[model samples]
Target: MVSAVPECGGPGDLPAPRIVTDLAHGGRWTSLTAGGREWLWHRDEPRRAGVGPGDPFADAGGLEECVPTVRGTPDHGDAWSRPWRRAGEEESVDCPDFRLTRRVSAGAGRTVVDYRLTAAPGYRFLWAAHALLEVSGRARAVMTGG
Candidate 1:
C-alpha cells in the first residue's frame, strides 16, 4: 500500500505522485515519486549474492537463524517470496511465525509508511527495515549503534 501526492511542478511532471509496490517480493516498494522525482533505489537486475533488486527484506536480519530448522524457512525468510493480500491502501502477509502488514498514506509534502508485525508469544526474533533510497551518482552509508 503506497500512495503519494503530487506537488506543483513544471512540464513532464506527473499530475500526481505515486508509489508502486511489489507484493510478491517482500511487499517491497519498488517505486516512489514526489515532485516527479523517483526516491527509492532499484536496479534493473540483481547485482549481488543473497539479494535481488528492490528487495525490502534483503537479509532477513537473523530471523531465519532464530527460528527452528523444522520450519524450513529460507535464508532471507518467507516475506521475500510470499504473495501478499491487498485491501485498499494496505497489504499484508501471514508467515509461519508471524504476520506483517504495511500501509502507506500521502500528505502535503511527504508519504508515510506504517508497518505492523505480530508473532506468537515467546517467539524471539530479530527484524530490520531494509529500505534503501537512491541518490544521484555515488552515495555512502554510516551505521551507528550496537
Candidate 2:
C-alpha cells in the first residue's frame, strides 16, 4: 500500500519536502513535492493493484528502482515487481541473486536517497533510478558537477 511521509520542518531545520512511497508496490516513490511544486509524474489513469514477473508494467508514472537488469525478461528487473521490507527509513527487496536496499531522508530543503546492493562476490548487475518528472514540453534538463 502507499505510505506518505508528510511535510516536515523542524523548528531549526529547513522545510522538508513531501513524499509518498508505495512499499507494497515495489517501494515506488509515487509523489514528491518541494517548493510547492510536484516534481514527479503521475499517471492519469488508475493503477493495477499488484504487479508480478512477466506482467505488463503498470507505468503508473512515478519513480521506480530498476535493479540488476533493466531490459531482461521481467522487463524492469525483479525489484519493481516485488514488495519491499521496510525498517525505519530504509526499504529493501531481495532478488534471486542479490538484495537491494534504499534509504530515503529529506530535510534542509533537499531529499536524499541512498541505495545499497548486496550480492555474492563477483556478481555483476545494472541499476537505474527510473524517475519520471512532471515537466512541460519546453522544459530543459540541466546537469552540473561530475
Highest lDDT scorer: 2
Instruction: Supply the TM-score for candidate 1.
Output: 0.59
**How well does candidate 1 score on lDDT at residue 94?**
72
User: Local distance difference test, per candidate?
Assistant: 0.55, 0.81
Worst 10 residues of 2 by lDDT: 44-53
Task: Give the TM-score of each candidate.
Answer: 0.59, 0.85
Question: Could you give me the TM-score of model 2 versus the true structure?
Answer: 0.85
List of clashing residue pairs for candidate 1: none
In Å, residue 128's CA in model 2 sits off its true spot by: 0.4
Going through the candidates in the order shown, the clash numbers are 0, 0
Model 1 stretches with alpha carbons more than 4 Å out: 1-17, 46-73, 138-146
Q: How many clashes does the backbone of model 1 have?
A: 0
Cα error, residue 118 of model 2, in Å, equals 1.0
